[model samples]
Target chain A: MKCRGLVSLLLLCAALGWVLVYSLWSIAFNPVGGSLPEQVSKAMADSGVDHPITAVLLNFRSYDTLLEIGVLVIAAIAGISMARLPSLEDPAFRTHDALLDALQRWFVPLMWLVAGYLVWAGAHQPGGAFQAGAVLAATGVLMRLGGMPMGFLQPGYLLRAGLILGFAVFLLVALVTAVVGDAFLAYPAGTAKYLILLIELFLTLSIAMVLLSLFVAAPVNDAPESQEGHQ
Target chain B: MTPDLFYAFTGLVLFITGLFGIIALQHLLRKLLAFNLMGSGTFLMLVGLAQHRNGTDPVVQALVLTGIVVAIAATALALVLIRRYYHLAGRVSLERDATDEGRP
Candidate 1:
């Protein structure tokens, strides 16, 4: 036992040492940096694209954002389908715990209020659709844990609408822009910020609903062992 | 040290810690948490790299933002799979017998 413990200690020390060395090397030799070529910077300056990060995400790499949204949509749909609780099974799953029941009485409304604030805050700050959605999902999880009836949640229609809302709104805005003679997804300079904010708001609501549905759909074997034995 | 350097170092530490946690933890949920930690570390690194005198790189921020969404989607799927497995098997850990395909 002593020898084994000593060996494990030595291995841990070695691993820690290696990690330290790697961290130092990575920090010192970051490959992302290079002096911007004068022509490139000049062109960017001429085009008035001041923020390189914005230019890359919004212009040079917008396709990645589009794909990411698509993935989110797919995941939400899959989660909802998997977690669909039939009306018959819903009543059987309701919780009888008094303590949980009491706590949820106060917590549910509070969570919704907070989630709304988080969604609104996303427009001008670090809070956005993702954060707000996660918060709302947590509330849903809380409700489920409290033994609230699944039928009250309106799981199907709410989820379907949410899954489509963000992408649809974003596409609609882009289409409008295109119709007005701008390139696809390119908003007029003054309106771009507002447009992005609008898209983000929808995105957050959709994301929250999707996440909540995913969490709630975590499978539980409601079937009794007697039924399984007979089968 | 510069703020950029500070953020970079913090991110590096977070990444390493998350790597260690991913390797050491037995629970799938813990592994997911570690993965998220690693992602946050990467985000920090990206943001740190973008911090410049003129301004930060919008492209990297946007890319990272997009990556965050994708990660969550993948995570949601994995969680669903985990939940399903747990429900069916009554255990989360993979057993040696299962690992050995048809040995039994």
Candidate 2:
């Protein structure tokens, strides 16, 4: 036991030491830097947002954000399908209490407000659709944890609509831009702000839905037996 | 060391720590937490690198923002999978033999 413990400790120290040395060498010798940021931020002066990060996310690097939203959607879909059968008991079945109700009343509204503000502030500040969406998703998770019925929380087709809303709008915008111009996502001059805001709004709602669905999964049942290649 | 380098080294430490935890711990939930901690460390390093003489590099900031969103999505998926595995196998650890395979 003592020998094994000493070996483990030596391994840990060696790993830490190696990481420290590598980091110091990079920081001191290489001093890594890049110019793409300054150049792009300068070139895209009319990205229609005062905030540079927002411009990059929604304007300059909108393609990446679009694909990221796609990734989120795919993950949500996969999670739902996997958890559809042979799943654990839904978190919604948990017992609720007055304390939970009080906590929801306090935190849910605050989160909603913050979500709204984050989206609105994205144009000129440090907040954006992702932050807003996360706040909303947190509320959803909170509701689920507090035992709110899934049906009441998401309703029926409305949830699905919200889930797809962001992707539809983003694709639509990209297609229209492509038809009108050479670039796929290049918005026509003087219309970037409104279009990006619209995109962000839908993205916020869809992200919230995707996240919630991923957390809760579609309620279904199958025998939770060991199956071959379950690996 | 400069503040940014200091933070970068700090991130290295944190990433290593989380990596260690993920390899050492048996519980899936704790491994998930460690993975998240590693992500947080990476984010911190990105922020540190983005810190410039004037301000942060917007490109890095944007990338990190996107990363944060993606991380949550990943976490949600991992959590659901973990929960499913736990329910199906009757244990949280990923050890193959311990997960009901020994039952007749």
Candidate 3:
């Protein structure tokens, strides 16, 4: 039986290799390589940002980011609905691992600092709200694994605010810009930088919260038994 | 092969591997991970194509970044749906009941 499985896997790999070769040949025949157009580059510059990606994410296509934030919120809400799920007799994580606790005492704060730095550096370099939010969520997950499942399930007000603040702020700003006679999300000429940062700050907070909630709400607590639950 | 071709082919291989895993795996967690693998494969292709030249295209990079964020959201919602299914049905595999094969 083991040999049979290996044979099938080898067969699958061989078939997939042919597919890869076909794909590579096609790309070699028709290459799709080009730099950004001059208009886009000039537009990115005019957006009052040093980083092109930050400019695209926060200025050029801000609406998409807003909807992306909405998607995250909806996902978090769905995940949180399963928070009342039935876990195993033993808790999901070790209630107290001294080593984990000792490390978290210092590491978590440092992690937050790095996350903040990522958000700040986004103004010019590769780091940004999403990177910072992901790092922040990593700390949240670490804290939970360190016996504090409540790290993400903090007070009701904080939870609601963290989840809604980003979406609400983005919407409000879009509306304000439209009312001011600019397009939706078109920052008043000179104020694009501050507005983008403001939007990113809220987005980072909400994204961190959403990811943390998603991790806490996953139903893999009874994972070991589930592995053998089938015939 | 040049680096661009190499990386693009690697991405395609990753996508195919994830597709195989999604089709063959019975475990829901494994399936979820395979989906993530597929997402990453797509991202690798985008970035690799953009890297065809010396400097990467900011527009493509931005789009890929957006894709990553949306992918996470989709995965989270998919997880919730899977968890709920398990809660109600008491199993993780998407297979039909043994007796229900060939039903309309």
Candidate 4:
């Protein structure tokens, strides 16, 4: 029976592969999309960023990035709501390893430097809020593993505010533009660079906070399981 | 066969593998991994197809970056939920009979 199942799985894989290849071939042969690269380049002067990806993310399609942050905030909220771990640092995770302690002391500051650099370099090169936030989150996770206490992540108004700060700031920018008789999220002439930089800074902080909180909020071992919602 | 097409084809294979794994695997964690594999495959396809015609499309790349961050959030949330479910149920698989057998 196991052999038969394996064979059937292989057959299914083959069938799907063939179908996908055919579709890709068809799409490649008869392309219907226009030249977006050219269009983006043409509008690059007004985007306030030298990097095309950064410009697209922060200026040309700011709404999508804004909504994406909102989604992340929602996910963090759900994570913390389900997280009733009872303490900031779980006993199971506590350790006194000298190597990890040394590593944390050495690496944490370096990671922070890299994250800041990524945000600053995003306007001209291949770095941005998302990348910086991810690095920051990784650093937080490392700190947690080394038993560093994160008191702010405790379920409180501070954690809640940090999680929503990026989304709130982005929305405020959009609304401000609209109030000033411009389209929503449209940066005014001569102020686009500063606005993008400010938004990126807040966004990096909030994104890092959201991801790190979610990581910290995961229920630890020895958590007393409840039967409240069980059938 | 350009690099773009090669990556696109590789992504197709990953997508199929992920689809099969999601269907065949019994463990919820493995299923979640498969779901992520599918997501990665889709992202690859989006970038590959866009760049196959237009050299270096940053718009799609930015969109994929957003997709990646969103995917991480989703995966993190799902993991928490799964861990909570496991704590409550004491089973990794979601089959009804498995739970019943364990309880009984």
Candidate 5:
């Protein structure tokens, strides 16, 4: 026991030492100069964009956002396909627990409201599509854990449409911009803020649906042997 | 000392802990939870990196956001695989090690 305790203490000390070294190195070697927050704030001020998060998510790296949406859609599709437990008749799946089911009943709707608020608030604050989608997905997970019927949770045609809506809107915006003699996805100078917000809103909806579907696709082991034997 | 650095460090620690959990745990659900912890950690790091001066490079934020989406997608796929594996094999882990060999 004494030996084991000594070994554990040594391990803990090593870990603390590593973290300290890494932090010190990072602080000393970071090439970026000036206060990051101040510089970022100043840059936003210069661009006349009011919200920093919006400016970061939409304006500075819009393409990355686009691809990120693609990743979400792809993951959702992949997960649903992988689970392969088609229809609710499969006996291998088990339902959620009673307490969880009751909690989910009350929590799902509230989460949706919170998600909507987060998406809307992204215009001038820290909330945005990603955060909103995460929140929305959390709600879906709650319902999923509650075993609240597959029909309500699974990704149907409407869910698929929602998943792509943001991409569609973004594509249209880009196409229109190109037609008007600007680079693709380039908002008219000064109109970027609102346009970006529009894009983010659609993206948020898409992301939320995609994430929820992914959660819903999680497989369960309650399928009966009759169904299993067929497979 | 800064908030970003502190958060980043916390995220890194979480990520490593998640990695360890994923490797150490045998339950599929537990593994999935660990994977999620790691993904969230990476996301935290990415967001922290993006919070740099010069207006928090939209590019990095966008990339990180995309990564988060992709991670969830991959996680969904993994969960599905885990469920299917459990159904077919009657277990989530590959090994019959003493820790989880008796688990149902």
Candidate 6:
């Protein structure tokens, strides 16, 4: 019975793939959207950033970035709430690899420097808050695996504040700009660069916090087994 | 064919493979992996299709960037949920009748 189901499912998937590929081929050959690159280049001067991706993310279509950060914060909150571990630094959970320890000693500070550079380089290049924050989070995860004490990640006021700080600040800026300027997220003349930089700074920190907290919130082996009838 | 078209077709293949994996695989973790593969395929198609028309379009690139970050967060959250489910049920797969206590 299971084999029969699998065969049917495979056949259905093959048909679906055929249809999808046909649609994509037609769409790819004949694009429908107007020349967005030309439009972006025309408005690039007023976007307050040298890099086009940065300009679109932080200036032109900032609403998407803002909501993206909001989603991260919510995910972090959910993960943290679900984490019921009594202690994060249980001795048995530590990995005592000599090579990892040695490499970590050499790599942590370098990673931090690279993350900072990425954020700073966002104004003119491909690096930005998301990339920088991911690097920072990776560093934290390495440190955690090496059994470094991360008391700040403990579920408390500090963790909560760190999780929400980026989204809060971004939303605040959007509201302030809306009230002061002509529309939401429209930075005032001459301050767009500074506003964007400030938002990106907080965004990097909060993004790292969210990712790291989610990493640390995974249930450990010591969690009590769920009783069959218990909630 | 242009590089964009090539990558777009590659992404289409990955998307279909992921779709099959998600439906045919019983393990929650495998399902999550399939979900991510689907997301990557979609991202690749978005950038490849958009840039096939306009060389190096930043708008689509930025959208993909946002998408990548969101996808990471989503995958992480899904892993957390899966881990919790495993802890509670002691099973890796979500079959209804396969909840034998010692068979994780």
| Residue lDDT tens for model 3, A1-231 | 746886787688769778777865776567455547444677876787889888888888888888989988888887777655443112555468898899999999999999999999999999999999999999988977887656326536767788888899999999999998568888998898898889889889999988887877776555543554553
Q: How well is candidate 6 docked (DockQ)?
A: 0.75
**What TM-score between 0 and 1 does chain B of candidate 2 receive?**
0.84
Looking at model 3, what is the TM-score of chain A?
A: 0.77
Tell me the deviation in Å of residue A129 in model 4.
0.4
Cα lDDT of model 4 by residue, A74-110, tens digit: 9998998887666545656777789999999999999
**Docking verdict class for candidate 2:** acceptable
Candidate 3 clashing pairs, residues 3+ apart or interchain: none
Clashing pairs in 6: none
Candidate-wise lDDT, in order: 0.64, 0.79, 0.79, 0.88, 0.68, 0.88
Off by over 4 Å in 4: A1-13, A89-92, A226-231, B97-104
Ranking by TM-score: 6, 4, 2, 3, 5, 1
TM-scores across all candidates? 0.67, 0.82, 0.81, 0.92, 0.70, 0.93
Q: What is the DockQ of each candidate?
A: 0.36, 0.47, 0.37, 0.67, 0.36, 0.75
Clashing pairs in 1: A52-B58, A53-B57, A53-B58, A53-B59, A54-B58, A57-B59, A122-A127, A129-A204, A133-A208
Q: Point out the worst 10-residue segment of candidate 2 chain A by lDDT.
A: A220-229
Model 6's C-alpha root-mean-square deviation from the true structure amounts to 2.3
Better of 1 and 4 by TM-score: 4
Over 4 Å off, model 6:
A31-33, A87-92, A95-99, A223-231, B97-104
| Residue A201 local lDDT, model 3 | 90
Task: Report, to 2 decimal places, the DockQ of model 5.
Answer: 0.36
Q: Which candidate, 4 or 5, would have the higher lDDT against the true structure?
A: 4
lDDT of 5: 0.68
Q: Which candidate is the best by TM-score?
A: 6
Q: Could you tell me how far off, in angstroms, the CA of residue A11 lies in candidate 2 after the best superposition? A: 3.4
Q: For candidate 5, lDDT tens digit of each residue in A93-133?
A: 44758888778778888888998898778777778888987
Using TM-score as the yardstick, the better of models 5 and 6 is 6
| Model 3 error, position A47 (Å) | 1.7
